[model samples]
Target: MSEPWIPIVMRRDGDRLIMEWSDGFKGAVTWKALRDACPCAGCKEEREKPADPFRILKPNELVPLAPNAMPRVGRYAYKIVWSDGHDSGIFTLAHLRELCKPLE
Candidate 1:
């Protein structure tokens, strides 16, 4: 069987990405989560090699953040250009849908 739905619309709400699939599922994902869950190789590598999962960063190293103006990745996926200057991640529809899970 084929997939029953696809994302028909999407928009940014402050730090969140509001998405609605064709099957009527509605959900929102925060920009922070999207940036952290980046599907690119470098981000994946950094996640896997975290020295301390509980470590907190020093304030000076933190960058002010916001999604940049361009956020499209062809017809199959989307990308986010974060204010911190990281834009390598590509958020595919399948992945975004996965992030839109019901609260347990």
Candidate 2:
């Protein structure tokens, strides 16, 4: 099989995460978008569930969305440590590439 595409450069700039792929593609995604698109099983379940329009959010739920840190996982993914205390998502490079908008 051919080698996977690698993210050679990754950095957080203001509200977006910027990345440059081994294939020369450059992209960026907002922190909120990244967090909302988290691929963890728990997150997937939450997203798949129907929204309750009448439910009131707790104060903690109002916390601003942001990435506190992004730690690499083995050889394929990164775990995003979010400001709201969620850190379960392991976003692979391929997933991240798809999530990002191509930089012109």
Candidate 3:
């Protein structure tokens, strides 16, 4: 049998990315790293901070993205339209799986 497809919802809360999966799992992803690795041209150009370095910092420095501008794309591999006019961060199933991993 094929694996069940789980729907994942992504939103911006302040400066962090909030994710809710169909399995009742949820987590918040910060913007600094995501912004640095945005993959979008705008984010790429504006990305001045280092991705790995920020991970060592405290959570207070990180802000969550506001939900007001959260993007909800049509049925498309759990894609999300970023608030900064970036609708390209298509969070694929594999990507989500990686993000859901437990931290060391």
RMSD of each: 3.3, 1.2, 7.0
Compute the lDDT for candidate 1.
Answer: 0.76
Best by lDDT: 2
**TM-score of model number 1:** 0.77
Error of 1 at 3 (Å): 5.4
Task: State the RMSD for candidate 2.
Answer: 1.2
For each candidate, what is the lDDT?
A: 0.76, 0.90, 0.52
lDDT of 2 at 61: 74
Candidate 1 C-alpha lDDT tens digits along 1-104: 77646777777778787888898888888777777788999989988994886889867338546788546687767887777678888888788888874422
Model 1 residue runs over 4 Å out of place are 1-4, 52-64, 101-104
- Tens-place lDDT digits, model 3, residues 31-84: 554544455565655565466754565463354432234333444345445444
Error of 3 at 2 (Å): 3.3
What lDDT score goes with residue 26 in model 1? 86
Q: For candidate 1, which ten residues in a row score worst on lDDT?
A: 58-67
Point out where model 2 deviates above 4 Å: none
Best-first order by lDDT: 2, 1, 3
Which structure is stronger by lDDT: 1 or 3? 1
**Residue 76 Cα positional deviation in candidate 2, in Å, after optimal superposition:** 0.9
TM-score of each: 0.77, 0.92, 0.43
Model 3 worst lDDT run, 10 consecutive residues: 64-73
